[model samples]
Target chain A: MLDAHLRLSSLAHLGLAARSIEEAGDAGIALGEVPRRVALTLRGDGEDAAFLDAVGRALGTAPPLTANTVASLEDVVILWLGPDEWLVNAPAAREDALQALRSALGDLHHAVADVTESRTVLRLSGASARDLLAQGCSLDFHPSVFQPGMCAGSHLALTHVTIHQIAEDPVYEIHVHRSFADYLWRWLEAASEPYGLAVVTG
Target chain B: MLLITCPWCGVREEHEFACGGEAHIVRPLDSHTLDDAEWADYVFMRRNPKGVQYERWVHNDGCRRWFNMARHTVSHEILAIYKVGEPKPEFEG
Candidate 1:
């Protein structure tokens, strides 16, 4: 019964968010660089094939941002949050791409909000990660089927989450509202201390 | 074991959900023409399906949304699972 008091740490002031990007600045974890990336809203026109094609072309076959490679963009990335949406990850320096996308999809009933500070990203690794996750989550994560490249959305400890399994290192990426990040982080940390959680940040 | 795919969350355990019953029971277009007994039959009667059946399920612990699935009670095999609002997909097979 290893129970450490749970503490919710909010990175409300952290400027930007990087989703599960591997390389980020000094903030530790995948902290998005403040004022770094821009969000383009695409509403009235729906998914502009021409715009997407243009973005795809701008990235020049090798998209600067790591595309999800699953359901949405190139099936590599998916908009799990809503219908007619896509999560486009650009390279480390993609300010230009954002502007290009915006101009390309100009005024079609779309509104993009900069959510860099709206959420926090936590990378939970180590074998015990799954054990710790089992404490509150209701999904069957046994490796037999939930292997790498698979992602699932569910409520863990009553908080909505997007869980992505990146490796057998059993590395997990947790994305939640910035306000709830602290609660979930503390909850996971408390559950993983004994299994030797290697807190990751960069 | 049988795997149930959620429209939003993907596949999950069966225990996390509750069986929601059939997806295709239709009521009469002109209900005024039917007697009270006939109305009750349409509203309360349930067909104890023993073979292939279309059922509804609420992934209470998962997506928390209702969905329809086609399964066989005898074999315990789920043929398909779809959103509750959409029309039942045409059985292609």
Candidate 2:
């Protein structure tokens, strides 16, 4: 029996630790959870220079103004969710960044929300990652269109998700609600069965 | 399936959007002077036109932005898509 007081990731109950993961072999698809990351939903005027400057000072990188794009600095990534909304993601240890954002954006007409516990991220990568995602998503994932640094909000297997492509190797980080993490993971596993799914831990 | 284009998120599947009935229905300026019947008409009545129609749509799953759309009822053709607060484009047919 698992300890009741132990902290667990969203996918921890799926027993990924016991599953065999191919780290060196040529698995068609690799799946893993990016656990314990801080997610903040940020809203502000994209056209306001002061708002942009304040956020840039807080995160060391200005939020991407262009739709369906992402801006990254060191370990923090800001994904454009709308014309005036963005999702800021950073490591769990970077709570100082959150404080900096709140302090810097003071008196500005903006909203900052800590949504870390509300959502979980799944990393899907490898040669067959695009193909597997294409089966369930309507967005065009062709190499020319959805390259590195691009992000989009779409539904996969009927679950809402914000997908960010972080690497040219076609690695995609799917941000989904914590409650739907298991359902999406199972769906991905089923969808990648033909291509052979390899589960990894990070 | 209709391919609707979001003002901010570009083109996306129709399932990601929700139609909010007719657009450009202005409320009466003097609401206190209006009778119950007048208020009911403003709140309930919709054009429900048979030909070209202007309507509001929200990108529910994608960017969650609300915008306006012009579509033909019979042909199911989308004529134009514009952002909120923009002037409605003149359409003949």
Candidate 3:
């Protein structure tokens, strides 16, 4: 249970946790967290025009049809999980978007869940970013197969994650559950040891 | 590592799938009407075929959908994969 008066911070001890690699250079690899992002899981019939229209109204864009693709509109990005399921992440708060979705999808046989606190995102970038991830990840990390603006669900070091390529410089975002944050961070650091890792904090 | 193809999520590593052993075993219409021998057959008998076999598999990690697969037990080769309610495909052993 959470304390009523005590403050709660998701990445509270991350600064201290990443102390060893503080002085590492930019040429190797830089790691950081994009904390406090809004995450909402949306599920509905993708073929239903009404459902698509409702989701568009809430997100300002329709969902992606091509599997593992992302429909990014301004601050909101919707990652397609399956034919009828998507994971929407936004930089801003999700109250307005959630309300809009509820009002739009009235009485539909669908599900919308807010999972902001369920997952934590870690940004991995630099020249050796892809090479570093290729150590333990099962999916092919070559830029030719996984290009910029593409996302995929894969297993990294025995943990499930959603990997998104945001830039051609090999900047990738890994979304993992909050419960596995510490373990994944340690695993990433261990995997990136040979290349030398630099921890970036805001 | 086996690479199983999910009907919805395409080809993914076999770690994402769970084998649901044997497929399409119909239960007796009325268990009370059957004698001990017939009841024992329905409960215990299984077609552990050596060549081509029909099996049920579920994509546990990806799409989480269940589907049927025709596989060669000896060689571990997948012949065909179809949906849950799909009819058993007609193929030579």
Candidate 4:
């Protein structure tokens, strides 16, 4: 386990060190097959109700999920990426799912992107997750402001990253690209040292 | 090297912006009428004019929006920049 920990570089080796955006099942936190076509979608232009309803049906859930909780619309999960933009991360294995959305919602004016190799999700848990984040970011990540079901995107360590507080257990998943993963991980670990951050590995 | 003043992140080097070929090449939504050659031309052809040229740039590392820039290809100087929806305001200073 220590060897695995040591493999994570500490020196800031900037330039494509992280993995691309990934999607997996909620049941398996920090473990799942990385989707091939991770859609970074833009849904601000059209009606979200029909699209959300369709996703809710596919995911075995109901529409109109209240804010402050993670919701699934189908294979694509509604992660509050920002105020107006929600990342619709559909797994590549579900090509039919993507096709269904495109075919049925042609009038929606949503932009779907295939960004599998461009981003990676790093699972940050242990007790020190929040402390590590506070050190590098300007956001007031108080428990009430940034807790479970809260997802925020901003600049971290000179790179663009979106940090999602996934669970009440304080398991926050950090997303960065393959190019920025190493630098971010190292920065995270170093920032977490004071609070004793244990690198969670599979 | 030319420097760009990002409306969001402030002034920085030109390395942050990725050249997006044309400044305003509107894509034809009705592709049924476009011939194969015409489509290819629109896709592949780039106007790398010498000076005072209007070009497209994407703030990949910053705001992540498409914007226009009036850049001199020869000297690598950006004369102006504007957002995608707004028109290029006349150069004031």
> All candidates' TM-scores?
0.54, 0.96, 0.87, 0.52
Q: DockQ of each model against the real complex?
A: 0.17, 0.89, 0.48, 0.05
Number of clashes in model 1? 23
Q: Mind giving the per-residue lDDT tens digits that candidate 4 earns over A1-202? A: 1232343322224322243224322322232112233545434432467765654554444222333234564455556442234565566555555556566556665655545456777766555556667677654567876677666555576667766676776777666776777677677656655665433231
lDDT of 2 by residue, B22-60 (tens): 999998999999999999999998888788899999998
lDDT of 1 by residue, A1-202 (tens): 1122432235433321323344322321222212222222222222455544554554343222222222323322323232333444333244465566556446544544444335545666654667777887877779986666566556677787767676786767666666787677667656655554433342
Best by TM-score: 2
In candidate 3, stretches whose alpha carbon ends up further than 4 angstroms from where it belongs are: A1-11, A16-24, B26-45
Best by DockQ: 2
For residues A22-91, what per-residue lDDT tens digits would candidate 2 score against the true structure? 4926778999887678889999999999999999999999999999999999889999999999999999
TM-score, chain A only, candidate 4, equals 0.67
Better of 3 and 4 by lDDT: 3
Per candidate, chain B TM-score? 0.79, 0.94, 0.90, 0.77
TM-score for predicted model 3 compared with the true structure: 0.87
Model 2: pairs clashing at backbone N, Cα or C within 3 Å: none
RMSD of 1: 9.3
* Evaluation by lDDT, superior candidate among 2 and 3: 2
Off by over 4 Å in 2: A1-7, A20-24
Model 3, range A116-160, lDDT digits (tens) per residue? 767888988888998888886767778788888878777788888
